[model samples]
Target chain A: MPKLSYLKALHRALRDEMDRDESVFVLGEDMNFALTNTTSGFLDRFGADRVLEMPLSEQGFTNFATGAALAGRRPVVEFQIPFLLLLVFEQITNQANKFLLMSGGQRSVPVTYLMPAGGHRPGWGAQHSDQPYSLFAHMGVKTVLPATPTDAYGLLTTAIRDDDPVVVIGPLACLGVREDVDHADLVPVPLGKGRIHRAGTDVTLVATGHLVHEAIAVADDLAGDISVEVFDPRTVYPFDWDLLAESVGRTGRLVVADDTNRFSGLGAEVLATAAEELPLRVPPKRVSRPDGAVVGAAPELDAVLQPTREQIADAVRSVLKESGWGA
Target chain B: MSVLDEVPATEADSAVPDSAALYRTIRFIRRFEERAVELVKAGEIRSGIHPCIGQEAVAAGAVATLDADDVVLSSHRGHGHLLAKGCDPARLMAELAGRATGIDRGRGGSFHPSDFSANVFNATGTVGHGAAIAAGIGWAAATAGSPRVVLSFFGDGAVSQGALLEGFNLAALWRLPVVYVCENNGYATTLPAGAAIAGTVVGRGEAFGIPSSSVDGQDAETVYAAVREAVVRARSGGGPSLLEMRTYRYHGHHTFELKTRLRYREQSEVDSWLGRDPLLIQAARVAEDERARVDAEVEARLDEVVRFAVASPYPDPATATDHLHADGLRPRPGSAR
Candidate 1:
């Protein structure tokens, strides 16, 4: 078994997909130098034609990808900052996303919007720091947030292969997470499925992106006192509700850890669904950022605003206490 | 290629007929807007339209030279462009009235009327996004080796958008068949071009090495001639062309402007633009009897269109998400299951 890092997985997926499909090409600003490292051997492996370096025009290049996708090419666009996705949000949602439906199913836009370093990158502050996966999910765009290296590789491959527009948010915090797997098993993981990293019966902790790893750690820390089921939903939009239902059915208590803001965030959606339909023995708890909190430049101000490991543990403990189900 | 290598510019072909066509387009657009306005007031149309009253020639001339197979990607202010592309006037009226038999099954009211079968893609409510989609359609057509082209129509405000420029670059780079037509109708809502834009629209296209030009958008013939050449260039593998047709919006930027009363432009400027009315110019080109015949036919067609649209049933609420996905996969309802 070989160990693969998250960034390497993305690079491998791009290289492999380009080689597999001639129509698959990589484009974005500073891609030639592999600025994001997601297209790291791309320029050399596939040549500059396939690995295009665009100017600092995020909106322009975003549509350029749409144009390329329309030409029967699968374009994988890498954005260095999470906020860049916001700048080109209209291009993706209005143009690429609606092309198929507006054309009455006459066309398909298979463009991959890969935010390699999504979410708050410490002192990166207001403009650059953002985790906007929920925005895409709300717009009915297929959105994925892979937690680990294998999942990153798998999801990116699946996104490229999908016939619709997909947004893959690779959290800056999770990019270094490595996993050991057989090279042959580096296969495409189907979207809308959940991977139960740690199965438990006391509480179901649904985590997304880098929060999955954090949940895994919290579950381990509370291993002796509580049995926690940490589930990683690879694709957030076409969420694996069936899997969540089954997990929560056995546990009867749920807690969600998400990276977005508290109001109308992914965590809120999960909590709402749990309360509405799920048979929860206790009120579910969610660990997320404060309402409409734009992360500031100061490290301490940022640290207070973002969801922390302690907060995840507290949310888990609260859910467990509400159910009175700790082992 | 030299400017001479292309179609030679002449007063007969370049200025007069061009101006005449511009007037015709403007006239058609003006009359269409007036008729639509009357319908809105009469409650025949539910959602108020963003009239293209002042920017008629842009639609008339640009679409005048397009083949029936050529595609058009329009904007929110797209009714004139759609009409100019030979869309059924009645069905268009029916569409504004939210009729089932309308172009978009009445799902896309006024702002998003689409006739894909006729290659008229609807105006995406998102500003400046159509260019990329147009580029995509062009790329598809070019790769298929089809002699067809795509005309992406947008306003001056859209030119500031990066996506439109991206569309320009891709079309120019791959020589994908497309014509980027910008109808500089003075203002994007209340935001004037002078206040928002940093450089000229034509200069942006020229930077991409796309053959860029400026035309009198108020004249239909000018629009038609420029578009015709661009269409020829695209069909002949000469790639994309960017034409900035300078014009003014005769009416409010949108119907909402009626309430805001944003007086960004002078009344004199509006009066001056009205002097070059597109419909009157085009009507002058034809005999009195011919003009009357066309008018009577258009009026009659609009009547039936209104009737059909009004009588059509609203889509069943149960199937509201019917066309959301082509696979017809209803998103799994939120449940533990």
Candidate 2:
């Protein structure tokens, strides 16, 4: 067994995939020095041509990756900041995402948009802090937010292999987490699947990205009082509804913990869908950042803006406390 | 299909008098825009088109030099490029009408029409993004030992975009078989090229060491001569060439501008360019009887095209996710139960 840090898992996946398929190569800014740490040792392992360092042109490089993909090469683009994704949104959503459909099934853009440090990083200020995986999912781009080291490795490998444009949001909180695993067990996981971290009967807590670990801790803390089922959706856009339905069917209640803004966030979609179709005994609840939240530089302000573990526990308990069934 | 067999060190002159082909291309483009404008006025097309009214010669001349296997990537104002690439007018019209018989099966409307079978990829609404896609196609073609060239068309406004310049760097560095044709049509929507652009459009490509030049885009004959040379250079392993076709738009940037009442280009300037119209320039070269025959043939073809487009059906809503992926997998419906 080897200790695999979340970042290491990402490095392993990139190295393995590039080794397995010669078409796999990386392009990004400051990638020569491994700025985001995901591309650490990449330049050394794969020469400069395979590990390309680009200029400060987000829109340009994003489309360049699209072109490279069209050239029969699989490109993995690394974005240092989350907001850079916002700058090149049109390139991804309009150009890369629309090619296959617009070409009437004549072309495919197999490009991966990897955001290494996604979500709020305290003291990084307003412009830097954002968790926008939900935006990609909403635009119908393949979005994956893995919860653990193994899932991160598996999902990233799968994203690079996918025929369409895919976005992988690696949350900041999950970067430090580590797990013991067999190196041989490292494999590509299928997209659009969910794994139940912990199964219980009282309430089904749907958590994503870094919040999945928080949810597992909360479930353990209240293990004696309430039965909590913690579910992590590895892929958000083409979400595994069958697995979610099965989890909620046993619990009869739902709670979602997300790191995105409250308005039209993934959390809202989750709770809305669950309430409408699932036979929940009580009203579903979601804990997320305040509407249009901008994570500030101050530690206290950032903490207050983010969804907390206590908030998740309270939301779960509240959903459990509700007495009435569907009106 | 592989038309350019040898690379010429200097610009190549057309062996055949290319006025007829150039005129037919420009005429098809002009008529296509006119019909699309009618559809836009009727509200049948939701996204108002960025009509390439006066900038037809650039597309006609550049695309005329390309082979059937060559790729053409275009910008938002791309009806001219489509027509020059020999895209069927009826299917293009149907795409504007949101009918399933369209090249994109009605998925792409005005800003994003694509026909990959003809090697005409989508003309992205995003400015300057098509350069990279075209470069990619060129790189792929060259790697596979195919002498296939890619012609990417953009406006003078795209020169300011960093992405377009980045594409220049990549194409020049790799010696990719690509030709970047910048149609300097004076205005990008309301802003004049002088106001939006800082330096010369040809200078941007020259900065990247790509063989760059400026040509009279208004004259179909001149444009055809310049593009033929570039195509010969690309096919002969000479790498990329950039041509800045100095032209002007006769109409507003988009048809919607006709409603907004903006004074961007003067009536006199537009009239001066229209006087040297590619349609008349090439038509004058042909005999009077041949010109009449070409006109009658064009009119009959357009009528049939309109009939086909109007009769085509709208795509079914159930297959909304079709062609999103090359693997042909539709995304699972948003989970409710």
Q: What TM-score fits each model?
A: 0.85, 0.89
Chain A fold similarity by TM-score, each prediction? 0.97, 0.98
In candidate 1, position B47 carries an lDDT of: 83
The deviation in Å at residue A274 for candidate 2 is 2.1
Candidate 2 wrongly placed segments (more than 4 Å): A325-327, B1-17, B34-48, B138-146, B160-162, B169-176, B206-210, B232-239, B256-264, B287-293, B325-337
Candidate lDDT values, in order: 0.80, 0.84
Off by over 4 Å in 1: A44-49, A70-72, A98-108, A122-126, A293-306, A323-327, B1-34, B88-90, B131-148, B159-178, B190-212, B233-240, B248-251, B255-272, B287-293, B329-337
Q: Write one digit per residue (lDDT tens) for candidate 1, span A107-186.
A: 57889999999997888788888899888888888899999988888999999998888999999999888889788988
User: TM-scores for chain B, in order?
Assistant: 0.88, 0.92
Q: Candidate 1, chain A: TM-score? A: 0.97
Q: Write the per-residue lDDT of candidate 2 for residues A219-296, one digit (tens) a residue.
A: 999999999999999899788888999999999999999889999999998987887778888988999999899877
Question: How many residue-pair clashes does candidate 1 contain?
Answer: 11
Question: Best candidate per DockQ, number?
Answer: 2
